[model samples]
Target: MSQNSPTAPFSAAARPELTADPQRRLGVLLSHGFTGSPASMRPWAEYLAERGYGVEVPLLPGHGTSWQEMNTTGWADWHGAVEAAFTRLRADHDVVVVAGLSMGGALALRLAADHPDDVAAVVLVNPGINSTNKQLLALPVLKWLMPSMPAIGNDIKKPGGDEHGYERTPLKALASMLGGWRQVRADLAKVKAPVQVFRSVDDHVLDPSSVELITRHVPNASVTLLHDSFHVATIDNDAPRIYADSAEFIRSATGV
Candidate 1:
């Protein structure tokens, strides 16, 4: 079934309704990266769901569609998607942990910081906090000057992955991402959840400094640097590593 957009949520009304069973192991909310779909988090979601944890991987606004749609939307819509999923999970589970990829990591961090009492824990993969990548940071103004700019470097998994990207990313959207990260970083002290961050030592898109910032800012944080993969570690060669780490973190935090 095709997923819903930001404003149009999938009709949970049609599926057999899930009972609010408090005895279930735990609930995990998976957030995908910017310009990505639930596809990015589906593997992690499936793993958690199969292991008796209720999991939700909602598609963010202006994503999983044509790039033009994403260009029109802002980061707030993406955060809204995360907030909506978290609220739903809270209704049925006593504990909720979040796992996010790239930009989604930023959203997860922001949510944890904002609702410290509600979020039990978080697992971040290649979280893009301080994007010092010169090529990406200069895209906004550069795009305006040259409307048909060449595509950014191929940053996805090597063998196969989503290739549908914005031919010309809206400069405003790029700016909004950086701005959101700044805000998320500022509120790191408010985040009480124990965070486990996975960094790709060979990541081409984000610098090591971003991971360092994440580890330093969060009050309680742990870092693991993976050597083999790039930015999309969730689907790359080291995906199993991410899966194992996330599951372990959930178990540790919720005592499940």
Candidate 2:
């Protein structure tokens, strides 16, 4: 799922103080997973911004509002949102790296493929490319009959480092994610930008073999395995590694 900050920002005061130097040319567009908010990605955005890389973590449609609102939205809305974010980044930065967690990773991969010229590289953390979890696939049918399921995770991991949210999930929402993953896989061959995929061996949600399938299909992909983390490796035990490795991969790809 894509996430941002704990709550929506009211104005400029809610954002981190960034430099106004337009000449400082580096940038990164961050996408959070489905059923999540920009709050989940804000920490990483802050990390990169502090290092002088301008970053924008956008709120996807249906997200950061309510579960019912998210159910009404689909993959197209989410992709369009990211596309707009990338367009703005391209107009401002010399180098742009796309990064995401879970479903957000799928969106990032799609952007890298469709806009290869605009993206310098990509970083995926436990990307929910394909559901290794069979239970989720079965959820849609159940959701059709019963829309809301109990919350999936123990807690919602926040970008400001808080884990609190309704565990109740919308079945249709997960179905939308599966559809997006299928589309992303179909376009994998076109993603020429180098990719760094971080997957946790202990990820409870995604199948471990999904990592191998990703490396095999992605044209220029490198894989990193996290032995001890869960699905949210971006904020779990291996978070530091994911953060460091992503920065290194971006540096290598952009030659910065």
Candidate 3:
């Protein structure tokens, strides 16, 4: 990972040990949370690749850089990169799954909703969609008044865990992200594929509403609670559980 520089992107292709058959190929597109770089998702991507699945961890446009730059961008920008990566994988593999960490999970759901027949399955780790913070309700006006807020990165329970993410959360970008959430929430029923979520029971970042919302709205959605991690469970103590179980879920869901 070269120390997983917050400035870089990450990607890997399928290296199937048995054959070159496209029909046997499986692909996954992973997205990191807002203000986070590919560093947060690299380990999972690499693990999936080693398991013979094509993986892509794209650095969202406004991420891997200063928060000031992020304030200039929003949800559409990030989701565009994800959709493009999914498109590329779809062209090469017959079955494709989308997985995400935090806000990335929202993007994954968006993909599954937008392409019901294409996305084979979905895996989310400590996803965030709705928040109880009243401040977000005022984003239409607050975004103009406040440029940023406290950062929401590195919320891992494991010692020495680092996501190499931004130190500030952009208000305008956040507002746009909330808008994205609305879009996905409204289209939740469009997702027809199997959905699996690894939720951190003791997460300090995202509340339980997200999992509740998913299981309630998205049919075929299920949850696996993480007892030993925080919001960034993808890189925390329960990360191995997420990786191994997610791989198994993919295999079972796709009949691979």
Question: After TM-score superposition, what is the CA distance of residue 204 in candidate 1 from its true location, in Å?
Answer: 1.3
Q: Tell me, by TM-score, which candidate is best.
A: 3
Identify the runs in model 1 with alpha carbons over 4 angstroms from their true place. Answer: 1-25, 134-158, 163-168
For each candidate, what is the lDDT? 0.74, 0.73, 0.88
Q: Write candidate 3's Cα lDDT for 225-246 as tens digits.
A: 9999998888899989899999
Per-model clash counts, in order, read 0, 16, 0
For model 3, the stretches where C-alpha displacement exceeds 4 angstroms are 1-7, 18-23
Question: What TM-score would each prediction reach against the true structure?
Answer: 0.85, 0.85, 0.95
Q: Compose the digit string of candidate 2's lDDT tens values, residues 161-223.
A: 442333567678778777888888888888889999987777665675556767988878888
Model 3's lDDT to the true fold? 0.88
The parts of candidate 2 lying over 4 Å away from their true place are 1-5, 9-24, 136-140, 154-165
Q: After superposition on all CA atoms, what RMSD does each candidate show versus the true structure?
A: 4.1, 4.3, 2.0
**Model 3: per-residue Cα lDDT at residue 162:** 93
